[model samples]
Target: MSVPSGLPQDTPVAGGEQRVLRFSIAATAVVAALGIVFGLMSGSYAIVFDGIYSLADGATSLVALLVVNLIAGYNASGSQNRRLAEKFTMGFWHLEPMVLGATGLLLSGAAVYAFINAIGSFLTGGRPLQFGQAIVYAIATVLISLGMAWYGRRANRHLRSELVAMDIRGWLMSAAITAALLVAFIVGLAIQGTSLEWMSPYVDPAVLALVCLVIFPIPLGVVRRALEEILLVTPTALKQHVDAVAQAVVERHGFLSHRAYVAKVGRGRQIELYFIAPAGWPARTLEEWDALRDEIGEAIGDDSPDRWLTIAFTTDREWAE
Candidate 1:
């Protein structure tokens, strides 16, 4: 199967594995649009704040889509095609740092702006939300948030994409904020439905704090990933799986003198280990080595734009490294 733009659709992806990704993409766009509408209609500073958050989330979806495309690797037409494809698969690695810093700044600015605006409104005699309009908006916001969370969790299960999981968290928090507002609305609606309404304006800070809390992790994750990639640390999970594969080869082949080194390259795995066997296997020895290479490729080769190349070498026992 292939995605329309000539991209490889056969490979499995976190969100792109079938039509699940289409659900996520469509959901993101809908949520963002709804958020903007509610923000404008209710004058609920919290909702407006969430609207900005939603915009960022929309941008994140765009970035994720780009990443998915890169991993799919449908466009290659030159001598550097392979290299470019690999780099594209690894694009998320490079994009994270820059995206993190910018998102941090944007979120911080928005929080500060909202807080200032809210305080200014409060100083000028905090205005109360129009019950009918605000209640409808809150309900819509809450429903959207909840829907996003559900979709995000589903996407996480399907795609195993960390970014999609993060999106779920973002949506969950947005939903929670809206849920809180819904409660406040109910409480106000109960206390003469508008006679007691200080809580509505007060909750913005709490929600704003939540937004900051959410933004805090994005940069940290980016930094952690960057550090690992920079230090060339093989991801423990991938390394362990590779080791198991290599060790099995050794055990099965009865090779006594073999050294193994494995590293991760983008989504593809790399094996840089050497194995040595006795020179007496005759024609069978070469056959075994060739079989090993093929095995390594089949077992762990992603061959995606974001794949790692696992290289295995074999030599006579005396020549083993």
Candidate 2:
């Protein structure tokens, strides 16, 4: 048997997260537009690629914002929007991993494509660019990207949101890329009219290739995590804790045995515990059973809206098995 318990959802944190994402989206749009325009004016493929990456990042952030809203609205206690809850009975936790996976794959693919293009350009004797225009654009973009990355990290300290964290990483990556571009542009500018001036044309493609190599592997961690959640892989730590709790409960209550099942999907933790009572144990009232369940829940800890916990007691081992 199971007793439904009420838990307060952190709506304020969710709202704060949404606000940060909206700000990021707006900033990304402006930066992307600037990148494209400056890239065309300066004839820098690296700048154009930066703009394209920002555009794709903005799209993923938009999707992340939607998922956050759905999760917050549906999970809120006493929410009147039963339509979503009714339709998505398992909750919106699954969407989190899907979004993460998509973001990682999209960003990784972009990096790979950029790397290939950089190689092709390098092989074609590289292309000369207006270092003055490119440097100006890179400096401005570096400042903006750094500011956004700092803001995201600061906000995520309290929020601890995966979407926001991913966004923070994106911003940092952007900042690093722009900073490298600024340095490359400066070197290219300094070498003009000198013996090293011949190397200016190769700087952009070489730096772009190096940046792509650095970025391509960064998102693989997120992808691996998302795949684990999507597969409903039982988290080892969570499973161990649940098993310990169940074993303690069985020993304390003198139960024949216990079965525990645990899995983590996104921010949600699903746990099921079954205590196998003796064959001829005395029957307890419904209230007593509920109290036992509460005890077990408290022992397991982490009482949150994201936790889906169910405890049952039965004499038949077949039921638990």
Candidate 3:
């Protein structure tokens, strides 16, 4: 959606570029279901674990989808004024990443469990694994990984969506894991009659576990960051940026002192900012008010060290003197 008007006191801003997140949501959901089905059908433990993690990814994707809709101005049929009224009531889209982050943590924990079982298998000689299944799984893994990497980066290009970029990394890691499984499985099968049967099976789970341990951190970090925002925790640098932007308007444009506080919403290249403006900034008349709005948009314009953004500006008529 186009950026919202640059007023914060009363208006709401939309955020999060649609390309990166929407693609991810659809892709992950499909892959999650595929992984679950294939894993269960083939009786592949590693694949089963992959399915579980994929399901978690699906959950996050669903969240991203919702957040994207919110930011993209998803609304029921209505006129501009009616749509704006709804927008004003809903505020901005800020909770998408929170859902993603939490889901990532759940996947990480599950990966840990998968990892432990892999190591534990040294005693049981590892479980019987289908070498052919490894190939199929790997193929799917690579396709999904490449697709995600492409879209995730594409999203970053358009909206600077680090979350989407993060998704790319996750998918790449999954592909790598599957590739390792395929290679190891094939090699072990070749040497099965000799001295590598035990080793072959062991290798698959060991590698899977190792991959899980390595890949799990990505989502965990995402989750932690998501929680911070969801819980009203603000980063020092972000707080500084908000404060700086607001203070600059006051100092340069003669806005009321300490009269505005701005907070950034959304993730990635798309940012939505909410701020207060002094009522007495020569905006007494209707035309002056409209001019003030234009001034705010130009001042904070999507050029505030951001590629895509929505900065909502609102006059503090009731509070500011």
Number of the top TM-score candidate: 2
Q: Predictions ranked by TM-score, top down? A: 2, 3, 1
Between candidates 1 and 2, name the one with more favorable TM-score.
Answer: 2
> Which regions of candidate 1 are displaced past 4 Å?
1-26, 75-127, 152-158, 188-201, 210-231, 248-268, 276-286, 295-307, 314-321
TM-score attained by model 2? 0.95
TM-score for candidate 1, please give it.
Answer: 0.67
Q: Would you list the clashing residue pairs of candidate 1? A: 14-159, 15-159, 267-306, 267-307, 268-307, 268-308, 269-308, 271-310
lDDT of 1 at 190: 66
**lDDT per residue as tens, model 2, 1-321:** 643332224478888989999999999999999999999999999999999999999999999999888888775656565675777777888899999999999999999999999999999999999999999999889889989999999999988888999999999999999999999999999999999998988998999999999999999999999999999998999999999989998899899899988877777788888888988888788888888888899999988777888888888989898
- Kindly list the per-residue Cα lDDT of model 3 for residues 152-221, writing each as its tens digit: 6765665555456666676776677667666766775687678656576676666677777777776777
Q: Return the TM-score for each candidate structure.
A: 0.67, 0.95, 0.70
Cα error of candidate 2 at position 278, Å: 1.1
**Candidate closer to the true structure by lDDT (higher is better), 2 or 3:** 2
Local accuracy by lDDT, each model:
0.57, 0.89, 0.61
On lDDT, the leading prediction is 2
